[model samples]
Target: MTVNFNARPLTKALIFRIQKQNMHYSNSKYWDFCAPVAGILLTLSFAPFDYSWLALAAMAFLFAAWRGCSAKRAALRGYLFGLGAFGSGVSWVYISMHDFGGAGALESSLLTAVFAAFWALFPALAGYLSVKMKGPGQVILTPVIWMLVEYLRGYWVLNGFPWLQLAYSQLETPLAGYIPVLGAYGAGFIAALTASIAVEICRGKKRLLLITALTILWGTGALLRNQTWTHEIGQPIRVSMIQGNIAQDQKWRPENKINTLLKYKRMTEEHWDSNVIIWPETAIPAYLDQVQDAFLAPLANDAKLHNTDLIISVPVQETAPVKNFNAVITLGKEQGMYRKTHLLPFGEYLPLQPLSGFVLDLINIRLGNFTPGTATQPLLKAGGYPFITLICYEDVFGDLSVRGLPDAAFLVNVTNDGWFGDSIEPHQHMQMARMRAIETGRFLLRSTNTGMTGIVSSKGEIVGQAPLFQETALTGTINPMGGMTPYARWGDRPVIGLMVVLLLGLLGYGKVNVGRISVTAV
Candidate 1:
């Protein structure tokens, strides 16, 4: 008698045991403990750490935690994950609130917590919706839902905070190739999709198909990197960026104001041979009307004498409604003024009226009450070429950065990162600025107060950078670029519209399939 040893049943039993074990753990306290740790892992994927690959693993961990869970449980896990991510990632808010906003350490901590918790709700909503929309095509549905919620968080709520976006973390990866074609949000969707597929593969679902899909997605991105989206239009021009390294607390002091002006002026005079010179945000530390004649006129004359354009940032007090604008003005060889359109909600202006006022007053945190500038303002000219100007926080918005593109030859961002002190905020800010360069295929000349002043190439690589916390002149040459990247042409609309359609299609398909199965069973 020949005994046939059937190994298929034994293999099936082993696989079933493993899956059951996974399900039990996923529904237990283990997932709750793992959620926040996964968030920290996500934070580590960003600047100052830059473990980009960890981003995939981090999201996979969160997805696993959400799998086989109810919507409420998933939301809780997501909220915990967000608390960990934002708490560690943007704790620099504490530095700004305590060090600059005049809030006590304890008060700053509480306010910072509140800020993180509030933003965490976006992820919670994503988790809740993901579970509600779960179906046979959940691998695709989960990532689409996640990115849609990220869009709401980054563009809509409270004037938007686009920081800590997953796309920014993938700047060094092949996924960055997607930026020019799809912009930041689209790239983020790809990243989220990659992570979602990875989670499903681990669950032993459509392993071969998911693997092939990932290979195609990543391979296509790698190929896209070699494609030229924008080209140089003019000769390389010498540019100088002066980092004033001005202390936030002392910047507005009456006595230090003159020294600040003189410091930047002295630095500019040294680099006058350059085609263009840039000063960081509010480098003048005073209203434009106050210094137009006494300081700016002579400086403009000197810049003209040296055959260079001087681009500087100063607060402009406008009359009609007595509104104050954070403005950038170009002088010397060219003349133009671009007022900042996007304002940092709490930092530049308060929202929610009396309620926000009362809360801020309770913390004794008095912020600027500046008004936003018009969006249709003309582009500023420097080095005899038109350029887009992003004042401080404006560069974080990818859509905002591309508004003047194709026409604008390069990008100039004037920022004062000193408010966050010697923290990761400057590094993160510089990282996002580099993404803008890649998205628009324009050289980005980023001038910052107190750190990370640098010239970013169209490929998102650093051409030249200054040491953090140093007062020095960073000199680099950039060729003015003229051409339209797909992102520059259509902005985020195409990607957003595509996401919305995919979500709706998946929901419709799932319903139809469910209906057919129910009728057949009956």
Candidate 2:
């Protein structure tokens, strides 16, 4: 068949323009497909990459994808974005599950996908509810809902994997200034709100108003960044953080136990001149009761003789319930103990007792059957300095980490990141520790097995750091500081209160706006 263009000139031009416009519209429809890339951008905005501004751009893309989309479509878009975000960011989970847990390659990949997919539901819910609930004021309401989901992600899960929270990316950004006053959740809310404004700017909506709001938000952060929220209460104390660099595969073997104990002992003996020395979590591979007579008692005597204090992590047993605790204890100065309260599901304890055997067989690590500790534990002390003691991943909980508050002078986090091997988990873990310092206005002395042993200042700066995967000790002088940051005194109550008020106000305004539009239409 031969096609002929015999139309008049004006009519042909109109048809061509219509076709061009339709083609442009067709091309624009694929923006929603960009959600995966948006997720990558979001992931890179955090720890290892440190390109923080990409977070805003990523969220802007998400907002555009979700705009005018149905709830189901929005959920799909959000899920894809999450797969990209958590799939890449928390990819270290696979290392822990496979490299350390003895899972086969296929099993590890599937497990990681499931974990990421489970958490993806939070953002999916956020997207669905944002469209469902935001009757008129979608921009502001969307981010508020997003923050609500972020809060739930840290609260309602099996304990919580509160990693890669939006505020964490801003630890070096001016937005971190809001942490002392509002806490990380509050800062995250602001970060998400800023991203929402960026989306509006992209859509060419309320440019002047959004610009002014952003200026005030960032300017306030800039002003607050230099303000000191906590003060030094005593002289600087010399501290040593010992990194044993024990491989995960070798740590728990019966034959390697004695040698591991001797290695830590030798390192401790060398560091006794320091005022305080810390050993990483489960650095003793055995229960405190088992090691007390053979190991700890002798170490205690040596520490006292040298006028030094030692804090060590061990498993502690309780007789009545036959439960075990992932605990830290001190010797020679302030004798106190801190048991880990926030436990990791499956890794620390099985979700249900019936499936424990099967779960262990599949995961293949010697998972701990730990009982959660009470929150009213005493503040641990070392070398006359009261300390907020955190074990392993517990420092990820900002509110829990600061519970000891103004009473505790500084913070100490002891971890064993050998489980994740030479992966990004250690780097991200260190980043979270720095944020904890910023939130509480206290220096953090972190000791880890196989990396990130360092001292972080109250301002979230890593003042001293040891090389990763090394068997070395990091020594530094840390001042015992007093006075509560606004976050420590009030906790996250103010931020939660503000969120409640804002959500209610937005819902009311949306109702009023819908009513007015309805009346105008009639």
Candidate 3:
């Protein structure tokens, strides 16, 4: 009898099942490689590279890796991916810590690792919840959980580090049209949902349905791109954004302070013909009380003569024990002030004040102690236009940036990005500033210390920009917009509510007894 050497059907079926299982929750060593690769893809999807489509691919890979995974294995996979994403995407943190904050290399690396790991827990939580809530709707539930966690991550810990959010990558894409309607969380929801559906298509589960859904979802965004939500209330005004490019090391030195003041003065004097001339954060580099007479008074007089409004960043002294404020003060026809409300943790002040002494001993930085301004502060007036102000790190918080609302005519973001050196931080900062303009439906006038000084339209387009590390001025015209986008009116409340509803609907649909989404390995 001739024996057939081909494998039996039963054997082939078992092999196929094993392969599918491995794609979901593999005990194989290859997962270590796959997870990190997926993470790097995610990192590349943001700011510098802006390969936004890769974000969907990254999420698909991650979702596949997480499928059928025990909570523990899923957490590990998620953590590894986070390591890859933040390790590369936020490597500038190390630059800030070691290069500028006077920290040792090992210390900075360890601190950065801890920071990345902490954020990794959010994605890990999403994975755990997805598996525990597994059912026919697991794909839909996964993205909802992803968006919820992202929203929480924006404000829950240490006043939040809302950088590299998935939706931010889509700002250049048609999907960004969702921002004005549903805010960043809404764009994130669609992005995550698209990613999950892509995973389903890859598994051959719902190819036609998933493709159609994606087409409709993305096509709607393309259609909404041309929709006008806000309109110009006033004519475009000439704005001059001066980039002094002052060295971070010399900015605080008493000797170099005079030269710094003189440099900004000379630059502003040259641009006096402009309607509004602005300076970067802490441009004065001295107490407001000290500079008001010598520096500010003279500048204000010159501004009055030229019919120009001058907005400059300076530290304002308050009552005792409250600490000083990072503030922007205006001098001209329309005079007002705005203090920074969303202060950066560690950069602006230590979060856990009990350990402040111990933490300060290890790493040192300038202007590390700052008091947050009141949330209801009035918008600063520049050249008879009301402008919302965002100092340095303040623009990262989108919801907070629009506090002034319909009352504010435009946005002014003054940042001293010289600390990060010739790194990606400035570029990333500018991107967030643009998003703020989109969220509020107002033009953004950004003035930075080293570069990225420019005018951004309400539509999130860069109208004009100065070169990085250049000591020059970006001169342009931007209209003062009056109307508010839905995001400005509602903030993230609607999106957050929708996420909660979806999650509850998923749990209610399956009657699955999900006691707790814990990190337990199989």
The most accurate candidate by TM-score is 1
The pairs that clash in candidate 1 are none
Better of 1 and 2 by TM-score: 1
TM-score of 2: 0.92
Query: Stretches of candidate 3 above 4 Å error?
Result: 1-25, 363-367, 512-522
Candidate 3 residue-wise lDDT, 1-522, digit = tens: 343333455555864686586664465556667787788888888877889999988998888788755678777888788888877778788888788778888888888887787777777787777776765588788899888878788877778877778888899888998888888789888898888998888889879988999899999998887788889888879999999988877788899988888998898999888999999989888899998887788889889999999988899887766578898989988777787888888788877875755766756544367888898887778867777888887788878767878988889999988888988778888887888888888889999888878889989999999999889999999888888898998998878998899889888865532322224344
Cα lDDT for residue 39, candidate 2: 87
lDDT of each candidate versus the true structure: 0.90, 0.84, 0.83
Q: Which ten residues in a row have the lowest lDDT in candidate 3?
A: 512-521
Model 2, runs deviating above 4 Å? 1-29, 352-366, 516-522
Q: Look at candidate 3 and tell me the lDDT of residue 468.
A: 91
The worst-scoring run of ten residues by lDDT in candidate 2 lies at 513-522
Candidate 1 regions exceeding 4 Å error are 1-23, 518-522
74-162, model 1: which lDDT tens digit per residue? 99999999998999999999999999999999999998999999988887888999988876688989999999999999999889898
For candidate 3, the per-residue lDDT at 222 reads 88
